[model samples]
Target: MRILLVGDEASLPAELSDYIGDLGEEWQVQTVPDGNAAISAVATSSIDAVIVAPVLPDLTAATLLGQMRTLRPETIRIALIDANASHRPPSARIIGMAHRFLPLPLAPEVLLEALTSLEELRELLDSPRLRSSIGRIEKLPSPPHLYLSLMHALEEDDDSSTEDIAKLVAADPAIAAKVLQLSNSAFFNNGRAISDLRGAVTRLGLATLRDLVLASEVFSAQSLSTTERNALQARALTASRLAAKMLPESSAQLGATAALLADIGLLLPGVRNEHDPAEEGDDRPGHAEAGAYLLGLWGLPMPIIEAVAFHLQPQRSNIRSFWVTGAVHVATALASGLPVDEQYLARVGVAAKLDGWRNSANDLITLPADA
Candidate 1:
């Protein structure tokens, strides 16, 4: 695995470098003391993952992630918080670029686990099933210009004025309309009404607005049977709501966007029948590969694209990626009415693995829509 560690502190960088070196000869780790150097490294090389610190001399991790949006465009970006940072992982911060949040006083074991798990996931993804699924899948939809523009704007420094953001939102009527609809969706549950695009943007904020815009952008690109489409939508809404709850303070908008797009591979264009008895156990293909391929094409952040691409293979994914993938796994399973009892969940990893997910299983299972 190739990793880029960006921070100003000499000690933190040294600590991280030592831990990564323990992973051995195959691991290639690079350290950039500041965001500019990090951005330059990303622009010049291929990096699998990036670990960024929030407070750095030259720039904050947030600033680096924004620049990275334009630089690598596809790398998974994670925030490394000082175990002691005063502010929590604010929702807006997570929305912008953070895929994973690691508190400082870092443990070598946990760090190694994230790296090892990442490698294993990459290997698992190279399987025959994924290859076959990718071959069978159709095209993926691109985010509309409005959606892309907002993402780019959000990645900007404060110099990116609000008027610029408002203009971007105002340009696409269809995207704007969907943004308003989603803003008013039960997810937001605004007691008061949101009447227009500007109102939606105001009520939702740029972070939330950006997320919904991307969601609507991808929703327009899929083709699915009514039943399958409805199921996908239900799972997405349920996942989005759960994501809001689980990651109550984290951004990962792309993660939420992945939640909406995760099951789309199940909507493969040429598959005539999903329930045909003969098709069962055929194992000719699966959803992960198709979804991953589609997301990769859409320029989604890698963690989200990978999670959507590999949610089913729990044992194959690394711990950090597992957090997101596991959440999606349980959310989708609950939304689909799969059993979430201890025994069933044990077989599923999530039922036994994630405390938050385990505790919420019954409530999630019994939700009016999912039930």
Candidate 2:
């Protein structure tokens, strides 16, 4: 892997250099003093990733990262900012530019882990043709207008009420149905059904509701036949519920949301039926990578992004424990009538729990369509 470090040797701490050097001959590390040199190197070299310091001689870290984003969209971008600087709110521009943020004075082990994870993710999404195809897409789905409005009201002003967001969600039947369905799932429902959208919103809270709406909007934007759309939604809903049930309480919400959006890449322009002759082989980009790429661009949480990217092949991830990716993988496999990978389940120490999860998924599938 080729990494570009944008900062002067004096400013770029020695610990970082020593850590990178420890990776041995397999990794090529280069350091440049300022943004101009960094940009020039990016234009001339086949850089795989970039790490930029908060302060540079000529340009700010945000400016350099933003330009690098346009210049090398495939390259991984990491921002090294002071830990104390996190007290101030980050600008939207910076958030959109850097794929990952590492507070400086970072431990050498943490930096190494981050780079290792990035390399694994790159391998999971390894397809130049698919990257080119996604880049040329002119009409990728946008977040629902209601979602946007709700986010605006919540972020820009404090006057937005739960009732107001609930009403906005109710205005769209598709989004409303999804919210109610998730609210009544085994994870949220406590015996009684949530008959109203307002009650559903209250149960789910604003943050979780927003993610569901975004996922629903992407589903709605796809040009799918009713049967295809319904089948996909059913599988997604089942997978999401199973994932929530299997995860720990703290990460259950994120796991469910990731599973729900796991299949979104199937809706991308060039993607078609898995059995279609043109896409019958592994040469084409699968739904997992495409969905992850789009969501990454939309600035979704990194865990959710990683889950969507690696759900199809969770073993590709560097983390050894059961995380959002593992939950989604197991849930998706069960929902699609495929046997869970016993080795993976054993590796994660969740093999014995598969039977119970399968039962939960079966019950979810048997629920009333409008339930």
Candidate 3:
């Protein structure tokens, strides 16, 4: 199998590459820093499968996967995401239908299963029903052209002007309206409404706006159900608030992005779907693993990817970076609602000191919420 792995996480690439190498001559692999580069590589090369982390240094996994489907529809995609936190309904809807999602803590068995699943997807690729499914999936829940433009504007060099970003937001009335609506939601709750894109941009800041653009594209009316929609809104709002309070010293801008999309794994119909009676083993395998597989397909960053993969299995505990997924775990659980198990909290405490998986678990438990 020829695989293209796009992510900058120092640890995951090494581990994944080594694992593929151990699979012997049948498996070949290549690595890239972000989604855009991954797209270029795919255009010029032959890739059998693609694995991506959601929160990349330069681009998001969902954006990249959307692009890849346009360039090469045949390649199987697998997302690597953190599962400890919850995600919004729209993003979760996007992820649920992905070819595969692998979670963090890198269980060799699950990783192998994900790889094998790609082989299954490839076999089914030519089927008429499968082809139709892929077609619908390829259509994208959001308007892709507009989304890519907004992403480019927000992630431009720090010296880039906010005016350029404001112009991008202005270009899309629907997107602009969504942003303003979100800004005025009880979550943002600025005492007064400004009624303009510029005001929304200024108050939310570029990073928050960037995150919202991606979110709004997904959350369009087609994406939500009563329960799934409410869960996403609750998780996004709560996680963002808690992450801000917890990671005050950290400069990484994905605090809100991480929180808002944290529980995306749950929204996937595959993971949440009712179990088949014949399949006796755990129906979803693991929510985090399912999410990671989907995120990997989208080509997100390793940090966000890992957080999606390992949100539930804190005990699995082998993450490569603390900045992204670990922080996500701490902030996500606080936002989602605490575990019913006291022992779970104590276990989290022990892991906090031993594994250093973001000490915020302690504070998350203590404060619950900040004034």
Q: Write the per-residue lDDT of candidate 2 for residues 35-77, one digit (tens) a residue.
A: 9999999999878879898889899888998788778766777
**Backbone clashes in each candidate structure, one number apiece?**
5, 0, 50
* Segments in model 2 whose C-alpha atoms lie over 4 Å from true places: 1-126, 144-161, 167-200, 203-212, 272-282, 365-371
- Candidate 1 stretches with Cα past 4 Å from truth are 1-124, 127-139, 143-145, 158-162, 184-193, 225-231, 247-254, 271-283, 320-322, 340-371
Prediction 2 global C-alpha lDDT: 0.75
Candidate 1, residues 21-95, lDDT tens digits: the string is 877888888888888888889888988778887677888677777677556544556677665552333345443
TM-score of each: 0.53, 0.59, 0.54
TM-score of 1: 0.53
**Maximum-lDDT candidate:** 2
Question: Once superposed on the true structure, which residue ranges of model 3 sit more than 4 Å away at CA?
Answer: 1-47, 50-148, 184-192, 221-223, 248-251, 273-282, 320-323, 340-371
The better-scoring model by TM-score among 1 and 2 is 2
- Candidate No. with top TM-score: 2
lDDT of 2 at 338: 72
For candidate 1, the clash count comes to: 5
